[model samples]
Target: MSTKTLGIALLGVGPGSEPHLQSLATLADSVDLRWALARSNPDKARAAVPPSTRVTADLQEILADPLVEAVIVATPAYTHLEIAAAALAAGKHTLVEKPLDVTLARAEELVGRATAHGVHLGVVLQHRFRPGAQRLKQLLDSGALGAVQSAVLQVPWWRSQEGYYAKAGRGTLARDGGGVLLTQAIHAIDLFRSLVRVRAVVASQIATTAIHTMETEDFASALLTLGNGAPGVLVATTAMYPGRAEVLELVCRHATATLEGGTLRVQYHDGRSEAVEGEAKSGSGDSIMDFSPDAHIALHRDFFGAVAEGRPPTVTGEEALATHRLIEQIVRQGKERAA
Candidate 1:
């Protein structure tokens, strides 16, 4: 392992950026958070970050700093491609928050850009770092669960009308890309895709609640065909009152596994059962900023390690693009049916 400490910069200082800051704070030995670049207000950004960090309103300042070896793009969904492209162009390893980009084309472009620049590019699908999720992946990969016959994923979350949606770009297409499916449920969606390949989908979407006036759907459901020729189901919504923990249930030939509330339960056909506990604080049912920093910290550790070792991070740009492509297909199917 390389002993070199990575000099990291944060591109956004909004609510989404808080997790990055918290994680970096705990990883001081491996990373130096050199600068924070906020386009709107530098003072507020300074206040949000630690005292040791520098604050700036200009992107050029972050790019010009040779000491800044990597950047964490925590900006809006629509801004991911532009910011990540610029960072890669500057020869800085880039770690984007999620979805890679709002669209497949832009995400692909970013992957190409990162390749051309010879820099590490990663996405923050922190759920992959969750203990329960990790164990589930291990079991599936080891064939301990046998052949997966069917799978179901549900993300029924809530965002307060007065607190979350009141923000200017909460659920708008132009800034946020999409509603619950893209923002809230994308984590679960990515986790699902990590475990299985979704070959085909038939989906329906709607804005069924008056919780917040938004341009995109607050609810979506899909029937899917997996790569193994098994059936799958996905349901994502922000309209559920009081919200609930996200769940992913996988039924295999010999065993069944269910992950909910950061806990994993597996029951074998022989009538034996096992339970594994995950992080105490589940990010479900709370504000987006309510997540614990443990997973984010793990993600950053792996990202920095990959950058130093000249290897791809856990969630590469191309890997994240696959989930985006699936999301685009689902949205397209829904639009075609509505038309």
Candidate 2:
């Protein structure tokens, strides 16, 4: 393993930035959390960041710092491309929070820029780092599950009207990118796609509830065809009451596996069954802040290790663009059907 300590900067001081902050704090040996840039009020920035870290309003301050080897763009979705591109151009390894960008074209452009700059570009799809997810992936890779026949993914998460959507840019198309599917369920979506290659998607979306007035859909369901000729269904929504655990069920020729919350259950054709408990916590149902930071810590560890070893991170910018492309397809097909 490489043994280099990297200096990092974090952009954006919002709630989304919290997990990154918390994760980086534990890696004092591998990383130095150098600076923070928050476009919000100075008071809020000060309160959100560590006392030892310098807080700035200008993005240039971070880019100009020679000691800053990497940057984490935790800003709004719309700002991802600009900030991440700038960081890559400045010779910093860049890691942007999920959804990569609102559109596939911009996400692809960011990936291209990173390649030209020879810098590492990572995306925060932390679900891939979860213990249960790791075990499931190993089983699939080992061919123990045989030929996968079908899969089902459900993200029945909840966000209160007053607590979530009422925020300035919570559900706005210009900032958050898209509702339910993009903002809330993208983790499960990315995890599912990581395990199975998606060939096509036929989807429908709507913002039917009156809970919060948003410009995007609160619910979406998609019929997917996998590369291996398996059929899959995805149902994602923020309209479900009391939000339940996100679930992904995979059915194979020899065995079937179900991942609910952090638990993994697998049943074989030979009358054998196994259950593995994972790091489960209340999902975004009760509060959007209910998630554990364990995955983030693992993601950061891998990212820093990749940077030190001069290899691509586990979730690269190009790989993340695939998820954004799928999201675009779902939204486009939904619009075409609606029209």
Candidate 3:
């Protein structure tokens, strides 16, 4: 694994690209940093990667390079399909940032293109790669927790009004697609859904809290139905003061599991206990990219391995659609209630 290296390019070098950059930094040996397309800050992008890597402003140049076997599209949500379409059409493996795109339709199209071109497509939903998350997933899959009776997923986070949401197109439908759920809690939503399959949104409420004025909701609360016909609740908000870690609590027949931040603790009814601490950070506060790069690194490794083996990545385009569809359902239900 250490000696196997794949030619990779980073497109849309921006603040959002930091995690991916950090992952590539640790994966230097596993990947050849072929190109960094700055398009905006060429000098900054050049300084961020190794001097051996080429810095370019043109997408065509990166697409034309046969050695660039994979392209990581770290661009804005709306630009995802356009950029990723080119890469996939060129027969290069592509990994796009989360939420897939501004719209689920666009995301579906992007995934369709990858399939049409016979290329690997993955989304940057890194939560399932976290150690704690992995443990919980295994427990549920092995039936060690028995059947899930109930669950609660909460993301009580904070994003300063002046410094965060006020940024250009920060919480707008045109830019980020939606608010906290899409931009911030998507990771948490994806992670929880992977561990506990959420079957439906029973009821929901969405709102733009007094904490900030934005086009999208800064808070959302919903009642959910789990796959086992169990009940669950989802509460996500970026208006909380002095942010804290997100949490997911599950009450299973044999055991109960509590996941907060990067830690997971499970208590079996028989007095046995289990815990797996994760290093992945929770960007629940002001800075969205404040988490550790462990999950990101894992995603990179899995993606590269999947490409080499001609297998679908763990969080493939189709797998990611589950989250996107779930988010859309939450938003639509919430808004309809308001209307």
How much lDDT does candidate 1 score?
Answer: 0.86
| Tens digit per residue, CA lDDT, model 2, 1-339 | 467778899998887888888888788777888899987786888887778789988999889999999999998889998999889999999989988877677778889999999999999999888888888999999999898999999988788888788878878878878888788888888899999979998565555477657888888888999878789998888888877889999999999999987789999999998887886663566466567888999999999888888888999987888888888788878878888
What digit string (tens of lDDT, one per residue) describes model 1 on residues 1-339?
Answer: 478888989999988898888899898887888999888878889898889899888888889999999999999889999899999999999999886877678889989999999899999998888888889999999999999999999987887777677778778878878878878788889989998778888565545467667788888888999879999999888888788888999999999999985789999999999888975445555466776888898899899999899889999988888888888888878878778
lDDT of 3 by residue, 129-154 (tens): 88888889999999999999999999
Task: Give the lowest summed-lDDT range of ten residues in model 2.
Answer: 280-289
Q: Which stretches of model 1 miss by more than 4 angstroms?
A: 203-211, 280-286
Q: Is candidate 2 or candidate 3 better by TM-score?
A: 3
lDDT-wise, the better of 1 and 3 is 3
What stretches of model 3 exceed 4 Å from their correct place? none
Ten contiguous residues with the weakest lDDT in model 3: 278-287
Candidate rank order under TM-score: 3, 2, 1
TM-score of each: 0.95, 0.96, 0.98
Highest-lDDT candidate: 3
How accurate locally, in lDDT, is each candidate?
Answer: 0.86, 0.85, 0.90
